[model samples]
Target: MISALTAPAPRAGNRAPRPIYVTKGGDMLNPFTPTPTDPPSYLAKYTARDTAPGLARRDAVRTLLSWGLEQLADAAELVVSELVTNVLSHTSTRTINVTLIRTGETTARIVVMDTDRTEIVLPACPGDDEEAGRGLRLVASMAVQWGVERVVTGKLIWCDLQEDR
Candidate 1:
């Protein structure tokens, strides 16, 4: 089932409100279109390459810091890196779209979309000492909530993190 929380009431002179769907676990299911007056957000597309993850991490950090969300920088950086890396490693997609949205007063959502239709395998515990694996596992642990959804073009994987206050 899908549930949604309406975007917070718009600021004066802002456009009509939009709804953001969320899973029961609090992971965002839909990427809301931002009105001009909405809170800070970052969206960009990157070529699917070995360096994309690092580049995405840099963008994620810069965006968060710009919004005074530096407290989330560490987690956000790791999450963005892992998600982007997963795409380049697992899928044949040539590009990816990364979006960082301010979902609430202290909550932010990171979404990575790739143009591949492969089913996402839920992360399994990697045996210790393995030199690989564990990217998604790290994301699952850090994110307050997260999940993947199939989209017409490919798949959207999102995770939510809230500043500890």
Candidate 2:
């Protein structure tokens, strides 16, 4: 497991410092902020094929189960499936990397990274009659926090899930 390097002082916004995870070599795992890197709690790379989403979902569920977070399995599975499916549908990238991190005793994070740099756009308000375009909204409803961040190679979309939900 990677150790956290707490920031010595509060950030400019006065928010309490967040735990920063880094490599022993002093390289930041994520450029924008600290996140799990190098050896994530769970990591899997999948080709952008039809079976990719299912496989990713399976891996996420398995990882959560192993961590004794069975309550999050259903939400995590759907979140993983939708994120991976979005990557496959919108990008031509050959592979997608899925990472799951146990943030707390009953909270975990799910991240999907792909080569596509296009920013994700969500509908202002998807109509009930629409057959699609509700995946991200569903994710937003289920997750305590969700967002996308740009990396040097690609963009990673992430969401935080809590067992209470």
Candidate 3:
């Protein structure tokens, strides 16, 4: 599981807040500020055999770091791992594709595409004692925006988050 406490925006005064940490093990990191004209960012695609959930997580973290979004690594890793894990656990597909696309200066979309075309059930809040069914909750909680998109071959689960400069 990943945990991030967003830094509250500063009050009426002109003080811009410190970098809102996308925290990892409670450590604060870089700030992401987006300007109107920044170009897109890209991270290399990673393909994983459907059975290898850990590989997906490891590579997701690596990709985020390689893309220079240290601020997003922790949350991105968890989100990618959960999405890939869901495919492995719930579908018969043999492979999965993970892509990180940055459409704006401080914004990125995490895409997890699998050959399974089945619709995904948005995760419902589980009780305190429930051990399962919290994966998407982690994603929805951390990401600013997230959704499922149907593709010609299969469905892609996507989420967008803020990234650092």
Clashing pairs for predicted structure model 2, backbone only:
none
Q: Residue 93's C-alpha lDDT in candidate 1?
A: 95
Cα deviation in Å at residue 113, candidate 2? 0.5
List runs of model 1 lying over 4 Å from the truth.
1-37
Instruction: Evaluate all candidate structures by whole-model CA lDDT and list the values in order.
Output: 0.81, 0.81, 0.66
Q: Check candidate 1 and list the clashing pairs.
A: none
State the lDDT of candidate 1 residue by residue for 36-120, as single tens digits: 3476676767778887887788878887877778889999999999899989888999888999998887789999999998887
CA lDDT for candidate 1 = 0.81
Please provide, for model 2 over 31-103, each residue's C-alpha lDDT reduced to its tens digit, 9 standing for 90 to 100: 2222444333777677679988887887788788877899999999999999999998878787898889888
Query: For each candidate, how many residue pairs have backbone atoms clashing (under 3 Å)?
Result: 0, 0, 0
Give the runs in model 2 whose Cα sits over 4 Å from its true position.
1-40
Candidate of highest TM-score: 1
lDDT of 2 at 19: 87
> Could you estimate the TM-score for every candidate?
0.75, 0.73, 0.65
- Write the residue-wise lDDT of candidate 3 on 12-76 in tens digits: 97566554324233111211222122343333233345435566566656655656677888888
What is the C-alpha RMSD, rounded to one decimal, of candidate 2?
Answer: 9.3
